[model samples]
Target: MATIATVTVPRRTPRRVYLERATYLGAAIGLAILPNADLTPATLGAHAAIAGAAGLGLARAWRKAQNLDASSLKTSMRALPFLSAAAVDGAALYLPGAGWDALIAGGWGVSMALLAPLSRSGRPLRQAVEVLEAIEEPEPEGEPEGGPEDDADEFTRTIRAMWERAALPGDTRLYKVIRHSPDGLDFTALVKAPDGKPVPELKKRDVAAAFGVHAEAVTIIESTGGPGWAEIAVTPDAWEAERDKPQTDADWWAHNIGREQGAAPGSTRTGKAERPGVVHHFAKMDDPSEPVRINMRKLCTAFGADTDEMRVFVTDRGNEFLVSVFDQPPLADTVHATRELITPNREGFFRAGTAFDGRPVNGRLYLPGGAAHALLLGASGSGKTQLVIVYMAADSLDGATVWGAAATEDAKLRLAGAHVDRLGFGTLYMVRLLRTAVALMDIRGRMGQKVGHDWIPGAPDNAYGRLSLYLDEFNAATKCPRYGQEITQLGERISVQGRKYGIGIKVSGQDGKVDDGQTSTMRNQLRLNGRQITLNVGDVSAVRRAFNGLISAEDMPEPLPQEYGGSTLTLQQIADGAEDPEDAQGIGGIGWVVRGGKPVLMRTLYVDLGGDDREQVLADLFPDTIGRLTDEETTGLGPLLDDWYAPDPDAEEGAGESSTGRRRRGGGTKKAAARDRVKTFLDMMPGADLDLVLNAVAEDGLTEADITAAYNELTSE
Candidate 1:
């Protein structure tokens, strides 16, 4: 056996320890001297002030110590010396005698010295050299076997290993395990990045790979707890099950009412037990006053469903948003327009289609006391033309005067059977139609002003009623070199000033790009105060432009599939030389409608524009006859119509004739006619302001540009 030795190590006093001891000694001396001091007013005041300062210092020290630790007894013990000194000083101010001063100073000195042992600031350090010398060296042992891996839980260990394997920036550590089930796990975590480095973006695919699960099994969103935190959930099989499970009316009802309804216990088929529905398992009540809320986003993630598959709709009462889950997107199915659907409701809102959440998508052409313009943007095969047809039919049925302008011959043929008060084709005809619309808008405005109110849609005395201008393939006319500038100016004016007069403009185009023949002024005026709908566009940027950046690329509707729900021709069929199947052209009019300055994914009602029944459908959809403009409403429109039909001066004698094959008597031009018309109007309305004169001549179907030209020509003469 080897002998063991022990050695004593002396304590070394720290500088702070010495200073503390000196402070106590100084207090003791001050107490001793204070009692013998001269008994004068100044001296007494000085003594009391000094005592007060000391007492304040002690109180501050006690407060600081209390804040530093929850152990009140330990704090009091640490502050015992200062407290005692303060008490003695305070007593010296009232008991001014040498004997009392001496007694207090001696007692203070003894108490402080006795408590000195409690101070650990000068604790003794082990004498390393002496200890080493006293102990016998043990035989060298083999390298100690490494202890079992760190005591962290299995989940934590797995997370650490996965983090390292994924090559993710920063160290990911489990913060808390929110839930653990046989199907999945939910948890929050903290990411510790290296100094001066930002938290790395954790891609879902990478994280899933690290966890040996599919990408849809994982969800990561910013934690509301704080920055540098993330909420993660992993549901491996739940998503697959959710996708495969067929949704039923019961499920819809359960989600709508935030409760689970089922057959009651111990009840026969004939008679079932009556009981109140129980709260939904997934519903959370964050506040008693609020409706039961469900985490729709989280549920969607867990089910591996898209936004369209799991949606929320406001209930009929509008008190809560009810969740609706579907095996397939409801909008994927077509919703045909019906008489009731196209007809305006009591509030004058037409049912466009069903929202993703199974709620009716309603749209109105008029605002509270004014009309509203609309802009529809979509690419080819996006069903935009069909949607416009439906809307036009609705407007006609609603008793509005529908003016149609088609830039293409095909568009003209499509609207030929509809109840269009005035249907024009080609850029020339389109420009003429626009000029006429502007004149009518001005006339309506003046009429409203005369009546001392804005135009009302169905007022008994209202003569003009509602007027809607529909422009199909608007880009074609807006891009025409000869008429694009004038068309753009006229469209802008109508978009800005036509609403109050019950005149609205609806323009359909391939995209909303200003550079694509649509001037910035025209796009802004239309989009700023008008309703916008965007179907499957050519690109993400087009969607952004359509909604003025309200919808981002990620939020855009999924591209319209080539073959919607229909099956495509199989490879085997193709190899066998089978004919291609005629599938649905687009995603049943899938698109987005901007509501309340936010883009909401929706689908417009589908109207069958193809097949043999197309003609009958058009006839039934639109009125056979529209209310014609009365004689008074057509005032001054003759010259504009004549100018529109005026033959080209450059054409041969026979070819330079109007559409009705009539020749101008004096070989006069529309500009010359406008000059005369304006001269006559100004003469009749003598001393009238420019506005009054313009209003008086607006019924003549003359645009502001035409009037301005006539004015310039007359003034120059």
Candidate 2:
């Protein structure tokens, strides 16, 4: 009412808009009149020509203006309604009745009226043209003043820089910031590749580096929404918060007792009459005058109601108490039952000890129908050597040949009385033992081929019985300057291929990394196919390296303290030389074993045969009968052993050899000489088999062992 004068809003009309409207109108009129006026071919022909002309004009207008793509599926589908109407008119030409013709005429008129651009205000044509014209125009360059980049925080910029530095495929853009706090940042992102390429993986380390944080601080996981999408989180302060929030006594008791919340200390004491043997005593933290005693039965029910026995003791630090629940008193916990668990079970798995929950800790010498290499990793005083002896004893009891090697003099002395078929005591001996194992593996492989099957336990025809090679201080042996390469090569061969031939390898190392030399390949193979036992270590990294990330640092076993202080003997009694507690000496059998592809906490069996004498204890646990190899099985191994035992000819004439004997430096030269001799013999006896060559070389003072070694060396070359 305020504006008396009319204000006109200008509408921009497309080029040839009038011509397009006229063409459609003319075509509609022709089709409507043709159905009513004529049954002649000329009238129908005229109608068809008009419709064709209209379609041609509309297509040209669209192309010239660049408003729409003529070949697009959208454009073709839009023409369906008009085409359907035309088909009905064409059918009317062949119909005999006038009723059908009239009906077709009406349908054609209605379709054309709706489709035709009758005016600038016609909705169908006007809306379509506007949309197409908008699409044809190019979008304005550059983002608006308050665009995404301008609004993004420092964390977002850092993420963008990280993607660039990592050289990840695609253009990653932040979709939304879910959170941004001093503690962390959480966000979702979209990755778009050029020309529809796939998005590349986002590694955690790359993201961490971008934010100047640790790898564990950042987490990058692909979104489940679809491809080319990911969810990222960066938390620098989360670790500190978790570390500071220590678990309280109430929290620990609640978790252990399988309760949502801990019961009030004094409240539970009143219900002792209803729950007999449940409540013992309780005291408030603020009241020091009150007596303090914990209910044993209530704690026992946390493990299970049927629990009959429990052992409670304080840690060496006096900071916490540990309660071990057991259904039956663990036999391995006492020295009196030492022999009960050392024996191998029916399936050939040795009962090493019991877990904290009193489950049997069983490990096998060989995997029966699979690979049976074992890795024992722990720090010194972690009972690793004791566990190794248990495994050796189990194998010996099963009639398996046990070959032992120690990297140090002390280790050698400890294993001296074990049921070893062959024992090597020092670095040189360890290397020689490895080489012999490799040669034996090759021989057994060949023997298996001739027998037409893999080695089976207790087979009558299988002369090469089960052989278990135990390596103590393996990390030290691998670091030897003269024989490290050869040792690594031999270890790898046995780890990869020895299992099928009834050959098993067990390695014990103080350092779980084994990074001192070329033992990485061999270590990887063992981790993949062997059972791994990691005892209390000095640090978390040792366990991580041993299992190759199969176990995380959070799950690593707690390191054993240097001193075991929970002794029953009083200070005056200790001065009297009564002796320290037995648990103190074997304080740390506690460790982890990989069971069912997961780490399980366990304590190895206590071997207390000789009281405090370590050597006597080992010797007592070992079997009385030692398994030995037959002459036939030790054919090529004899010469290798002879060379190992032989003194170094290069040593000074008056100097005495060490207890472990001098290493043979000229063994390589002798091996080269043997290879040459075998080559010369083979050149004369071409196409000859191993047996033929052995017989032919007999006159030359060459034993079958020499021939076999020489032939193997030459063939390998």
Candidate 3:
């Protein structure tokens, strides 16, 4: 029979063999004392042969394992050599005279058996086997098309999601989302009606309550579970009717006294409290559904602003009041809100609402009561005059009257044509203060072309409502002693008391610097109370002080980098700590802010009345320098030219005409060259007109050289 040998495999390397050697060495003495133990030389020789062969075989197997993968079947096959060596060493214990040898061989066999299994050579194979045994399988499917909701429904869901995401404040609910043409999406929200009245929800009565009455009906329109804002529209016809009716100061007092007596039931109306300029009796417009109510004081305050100067007449329409004055003419757009600033360097600087072209215009602060006096300071060509013209024309359109004296003959003429009722205060006609007062009284008659007697002194009855006593070139006004005194007195009155009487003052200069005594008085009045509209202040101390050091050259608007223009910080802002952005809303020449019990900004529409307005006014004031002319076209080599150049008799009659006509260049010249010269002269004007041409020139891609060549060629004889 083939020998079926029990092979003991070594689990480890020589380190294992060394441990076995130590154990055998220790047992040698013990085994020697045994009766069956043979310590013969031949027995030792056999043990040595087995040990050597075992060691050599194990090394060979290890080398073979290196060539084959330690984790492969080749490594396992190669292990037989080491296992056979360990078995031979173990079998040595049964040989004759092998007592000591048996001990050594047995020790080596046990060590190799234990260590062989612990070796790292088989680790990779074990890991691979374990990995192959672990995995998973798949399961069946669920519904594919998902419960059938159309795309519109899905879109609606999205809108709802967006609405939820907005997460507005607690006391506020998003109202109507008006898709306005100019302003894009506008959120119309109602805040508890501005009166101290409680408004729990949007109702017809709540709208009426804002106007101090009740609405006739209530309506509710819900969205189709879609995402859109909410809106409440209400008409308070009855409340408006009561609010619009006119009432005198006495009538107001009587109404309040009746209320006090009625409140106490048995109380007598003996000594009643003083009332405001106007009063009213209001109740919910006889509508059960309208949620209208009132806070009496709020009604009084809102209407009281315009009631002092005229009778407040209520229109039959909803919440509309017609202010009664000289003749009850229609109100202009400015009467409600100021006109836009025409030649602003900064875009969107003063927009209160978006324009028709979708440009933002809202957030502009309107002057409280629309009655503010402005002090402008700028150099001659700094666009000050143009800005002033826009401002005044805008005011007139808004129902405010303007009366001003120009420092330059050109400006005076321009202003007169724009507002024909302007009183000429040029050098030829230096109207005295008393004369000005008379002119103020005669403004209506002059405008109507009806003759009237001059104003009589000490006649309060003839004094007009409120007048803007504009003294252009304020420095010049101060030079005249009498004018300065009158200005001081007038400023004191207007600064302190004008608002109550509806009078305002506007003082300007080509530059706002003044060293004369009038500076102190004027500055004091302005500081106390007045609006300061500065443009291109140019290191002028007085202008700097007026603006409280906020104005600078670099602050000029973007389009016109080199051009100069900007608004000054408002007075209220300066008074109540000018550091905060809110207070300094008007720091840029764009919008207004309301702060410290005043209209922080007056929504001013800069109305560029066109350069023609300026040119016309200048013609009237300085006909001499500006020259008189009639357009003439003669069929000649060139367009028939008539030179009206002559010495301005007003300046110095014998001064003689300039090299050309009084106008910059004499009339006839090459079409292109003459066009260039005229354009150059016009481009040199200040403000809007000049800016327009400059913009055009840039767009046309014309260079200075091109213009110069054109001028030289055209003017050449």
- lDDT values, one for every candidate: 0.59, 0.57, 0.37
User: Top model by TM-score, which number?
Assistant: 1
lDDT string for model 1 (386-461, tens) is 7787778777778788777777766424554346677766777777677776666656666767667777755677
Runs off by more than 4 Å, candidate 2: 1-332, 335-339, 411-415, 458-461, 516-518, 563-586, 609-620, 648-717
lDDT of 3 by residue, 1-717 (tens): 111112232222334335444544443333333324466886677556656766775666676666666454455543543555546445545556656555654555465454544332332323453344222211112211111121123222332233334443333332222222222211122221112222244455444333233343223343332122223433233224434689654344334422223211111112222224323332222233432222223332434422221222221112211122221111112311233332122211233222211233332112334234556655555445554555454434333445566544664335444453354455223223223332222232332232232222222442233345566676665455323433434444444434433345667675545455234555655534455554444443544443442333322211211221123356798897776443211211222222332212222333333555645443332212211111210111011111112222323523222443232233433444335433433333222132223222221234555555544443453
* Candidate with better TM-score, 1 vs 3: 1
lDDT of 3 at 305: 24
RMSD of each: 18.3, 21.7, 31.0
Off by over 4 Å in 3: 1-371, 411-415, 418-420, 427-435, 438-464, 481-494, 517-521, 540-717
Candidate 3 overall lDDT versus native: 0.37
Task: Check candidate 2 and list the clashing pairs.
Answer: none
How many residue pairs of model 1 clash at the backbone?
Answer: 1
What would the per-residue lDDT of candidate 2 be over residues 188-250, giving only the tens digit for each residue? 344433323445677777666655665655667666534544567766566345435787644
